[model samples]
Target: MALQHGVTHLVLSAFGCGAYRNPPQHVAQLFKQVLMQEYDGKFSQVIFAIYNDANAMRRGDGGNVEPFEKEFGIKASVFKEQ
Candidate 1:
């Protein structure tokens, strides 16, 4: 549908990985598989927008981004306390 409408950029998120309790690693892998095998070269860019609050991290909650960072081998955001 997006391609048919000439949309080039895409934005996605860690769906079902928060209050729904779906495993973020598994979700990330599924997204990777589809994006790589099915949507490759079909869009100008694809952005995975994952965000977690500082308070959430302080409470030991990974929120939505930690598992994705781990699955994708991305270092967690480093921000010193103000």
Candidate 2:
């Protein structure tokens, strides 16, 4: 309902790529398809919030964040302060 309510940005995730063992590639593709086909240009920005945990990424070749980065063509980097 974000669209109906005039939402501009979105933060998505790799749904089902966790303990459910859903393939990240497939999940990422579906997310891309729906957003591009249905919601393209509807929002100012779309962000995929994939926690870059090494253990969580161990399931697939690139892990949870990799597929999303590839699918969306952007690398999500966490900021750290020294």
For each candidate in the order shown, give its overall lDDT on alpha carbons.
0.72, 0.80
Off by over 4 Å in 1: 53-62, 73-82
Alpha carbon lDDT at 18, candidate 2: 76
State the local distance difference test value for candidate 2: 0.80
Compared with the true structure, the alpha-carbon lDDT of candidate 1 equals 0.72
Candidate 1 lDDT, tens digit per residue, 25-75?
789888878888898899998767765544434536576677777766776
- Tell me each candidate's TM-score: 0.70, 0.82
Model 1 residue pairs with clashes = none
Candidate 2 regions with alpha-carbon error over 4 angstroms: 52-55, 79-82
Q: Residue-wise lDDT of candidate 2 within 1-82, one digit each (tens)?
A: 9999988999888887876778888899999999999988999998887654555567648778778888889877855435
